[model samples]
Target: MKNLGKKIIIIFSLLATAIYANVVAKVYPKNVVSGEVATYTLTITGGEVNKPVISTICGSNVLGTSSQTSIQMINNDYKKSYVLSYQFMPQKNCVIAPVNVEVDGRMEQSNSVKVTVKPAVQDKNADFVVNLIPSKTKLFVGEPFNLQLVLKQKKDAEAVDSKFIAPDFKGFWVKGESQATRTEEGDFIITKAMYRLAPQREGNLTIQPAQLKIATRISSRDVWGGFMPQVKWKSYFSNEGHIKAKPLPNNAKIVGNFTISATADKLEINPNEAVNVTVKVVGDGNLEDIKSFKPYIPDVNVFDEKINIKGNTLTQKLAFVSDKDFTIPPFSLAFYNLKTKRVEKISTQPIHIKVNGAVKKTELKIQRDDSIKTSEKSLHVTQKREVLSKVWIVAAFVAGLLIGILIMLFVKPVKFLKKEKALNLNDEKLLLIKLLPYKDKDEEVKKIVDVLEANLYASKKEKIDKKILKEILKKYDIS
Candidate 1:
């Protein structure tokens, strides 16, 4: 009887828990300003001891309402209310934005919301920020680079009316920047364009200060980082950003540094026998236009060299094609150093080249006399058979006939052709008949006719002529 009473109490507890879980969680925002701070409150009667993690629903165009941890709600069991403060900065003009609410591990349904941002005024101008995109501490002449600017924003602040103004770049051309875009948290982004900077004179060039103005609906946010209490009420705020640029620190040329150096495989070369010499200029500078390569020595022709340029380095390969001894000339290059504020020079060592002309010209030739000797070894190669051309076949037939006549006049041929014996005719006719199929009676008859006609016309080996001609003429009833 006591156990039965305990079972009844357990049943009652489960039923009460189910009833408590049915009260759905609800959170609603209190007066939300466009691009300004707002507050939301969550309520659940007889709620669970664990607070439900809340998040914005997906596919919402508004910024503050969409990101995780955007809204923070403090539990208030005493007042039966939990409140979360948020800042809304909508990028698009949404008369009805999709604002999502999440609870119970699943994102709840979204709420249709109207959004508006207060227009910025002159008195509510924001501050300036300067950021050097593609920021490099060094540069060289004839180099291309990119620079960008952005209007930065503080936490809980919106970047509305803002623009970047480029500074004066003396002796350097200013390429334009791309159009601005607002980040998800409402920051204006400005991208600088690309440019080719050619420094006519080498030196350090300082870029001037760049400025920007950002217009906002209210006064500026605190510059220093700290918590801005949610209870603090302000009707207006301002936001702005600016920029300034500085030159490279060291005495670096626009492209880099310029210097020339040369080297030879050997000082002596036999004429017609080639020797290789390589000249390279290493430094940060334009190597594309350094065309002429007259190795500062005697008998060096610019035409004998092939020049190649990669980045700031110039390179060349010289083929001493001449048959005379010569000396390379000394070379010096000039470049600018930013730290020194003066021009720097680099020198190259002198070189001597000897071309021996007394050597055999055939061996000295570029075609290589060794190749001719290799071809001589291949001249005796024999083929299994030579396929005769039409001209050769015709010539052979004519020659054979002439030789046959010569044999008839000067040698013995009385047993054959025009002097045939009965045995010879029989043999010729039998051999000709054997060429056709034995099973075909018609073909056998045709062969017999062909044999008789062949004897009346010419030798057995030759085709049947006048006798066949007569038979064909008779079939056609021709004269």
Candidate 2:
């Protein structure tokens, strides 16, 4: 009888525990390739609980987490449940460690999960193959190289949908990429994409594999005894690539063959007028690494424009405004010449400008006429001098009034004019034009201008926040 009583008590305790709470862990898509994202969910039911603090999952970093809660009326009792999900990218196959969740002031353990992370698969018998090939794997920093992605497919196999995911290209600057081109090679059709890469840092870097997802169309019989179209999707991955970037010589900012030249619109200008000079650098290497040329001259107001890069050429416009003659010093660019296998320097000729209406200091001399001894003669001379002074003063006043009137009528205040020409934030191209002048002066402006320019000119497009743009315009009083 005592044994029966103990059994009854044990059953009641188990039922109470079941009514309190339960925790379970689950992983979706049990098998995945390395570098693929997988979802791990921890479900807690029948009680209140705190968020689970999971440091890692499947020996990989957790990218992010989210939670969802729900309430259900089961058997006339309110039952609450919580589901917490974690997103992680697994690099290898590993077992997920069990996590403990605190529920109603008590800790409940969850079951472990096993995940299979296999290396990227490339089907040998597939209809298509992709490859990532580099022009040269070994190079110096700032040296540009070509990386090409090529895909070859059988002409008979037609895909209904296709997407190509390029490598991340970490630690390297993507100078540019060419549009994909298709050509027929014997029995196969070939598609190729070329990218220009410049290493930003010296090290051994790995370029992750690129992926191509394709969907092929197939026919299936429907219930109506008619053929229906079906789609089957498959993914193909390219082989990984490695790059060994060696360090450049100390203080070597560029690597390639380049030439520097300067030209001025006019050698002579009036006082306060600007001398517009263009400094251009033409090269076959990493032209994007070239910095803007800022010529330093005392008493000269130098306004350096943003650097403009077009293919192998870089151009920077500079305005030097001064009341006196000043020399636009020669600009020099130093680069490691790949052909010569040595550091080389190129410089522009110094340009000397002449100010046509510059003011010059001259000594004035005063002489008294010793021959004028008579008082009447002296008085007449003094009256004549006074009359001349009055005439000069009147003439000066008249000229000043005319100039002020002309300025008021023709030239408006810069700030007021800019406000009047306030830009529509929605018009990115116009905003880009307005922001270009300020890019060299402000870092924030430069960043925004870069994004806008990329959206308009480059193949890749980036999102622009109107609120942020408006704030920047307001901050700079650019309207």
Candidate 3:
């Protein structure tokens, strides 16, 4: 009977201990970037009908609590849960502080949480990635603008909604939103927000709450803690906020239009010669529209050459021509000049060219006196040829007289003397004939025979050169 009473007492003590452990409120997930909404969860167990109240106060320059949310509930106990989300847009960087989440605003039985609002980490492939197209980091007022939201999900992640709460535009509005596209990289990206600014005001603004909800993966493994391991939930907050666009200034500065100017090394030129006209484009705005100055030039035929472009400076050579007097007119300069507060129109001075005559017309014609002198010189050659013909006739007369003297001396009264001369010649010939019959070939007889043959009978018409005579004599066996 005493053992049964002891067992009853042991069971009562164990039941009473489990009765007191009730509602617990905790704030977790410590790291967060500015403008990211974070969730704080409340778990209650072993409690009666006790109402719970949650409130928050945002830190100055750290977080603004004025815009934070609040909620109260009356039915609790038996493992009930509650969730609240808030954000901190830190004005400055590196201010690590704690946020106050008051549960019933009392410390005795109430709970409080301390968290750090830090910067966000860059996530390369996020579920809902906000893309600033053309990513024009630098913008002007009333500029055509657009933004793209890229959503990537694994097969198990939940569907996303673009109706998520977003920032407020104080001085701007969206111009258009492009059709969404699902790229092969497994992403659904829809271009949104073609924005432009209103006429004037200028200041930096923020897109308050850019929110996105995505499914979180759950795993099963029992652990001992206040964490409630198996409990599953989905939804979220994103660090990528919206449009911090500033309006262009009301009194913006205006830049001047490009101007073209002409310069020459010198103004004078010879006829049929060339002069170079150089045009320099100086100043700002679009320098591409300036045409070649050659076409606009008059009297001068401009030559085109390869243009030299260096940064904003443009230069090229222009060559011109004319036989008579001509001028290169000054070009007009029109630009939105910042000085003098108006568009200025200016003209350059006209350039003058003097071309001297090359050859006089009188000098171009042939003279009659010179033509006659040259023609007479040509006739003089015929006159000389006529005189040469008369000389040849006199030479023939002299040759006939020489032949007549020879014939007269031998044929008439000179016959007796011819017979006597022949006898003398026969006697000399006898010497050669006697030597030929003997074939002795003595050096003295060889010399005498060579002289006789050269004078009397070798058939070649050219002068009997001594070399051929000597060789013929040697071949006749006469040394």
User: Which candidate number has the best TM-score?
Assistant: 2
Error of 1 at 148 (Å): 5.2
lDDT of 3: 0.49
lDDT comparing candidate 1 with the true structure: 0.48
Report lDDT (Cα) of residue 195, candidate 1. 29
Candidates sorted by TM-score, descending order?
A: 2, 3, 1
Q: How many angstroms is residue 300 displaced in model 1 relative to the true structure, after the best TM-score fit?
A: 4.7
Candidate lDDT scores, in order, read 0.48, 0.85, 0.49
Better of 1 and 3 by lDDT: 3
The TM-score, computed over Cα atoms with residue i paired to residue i, of candidate 2 is 0.55
Per-residue lDDT for 392-471 in model 3, tens only? 99999999999999888777776555543321233434545644643355565566666666555664233334564455
Candidate 2: regions farther than 4 A off: 1-28, 35-112, 121-125, 156-158, 216-233, 249-251, 361-479
- Backbone clash count for every predicted candidate, in the order shown: 36, 0, 2
Error of 1 at 364 (Å): 26
lDDT of 1 by residue, 72-158 (tens): 233642223223333333333444433334444444333344444444332323333344344542455544345444444454555
Q: Summing lDDT over every window of 10 consecutive residues in candidate 1, give the lowest-scoring window.
A: 65-74
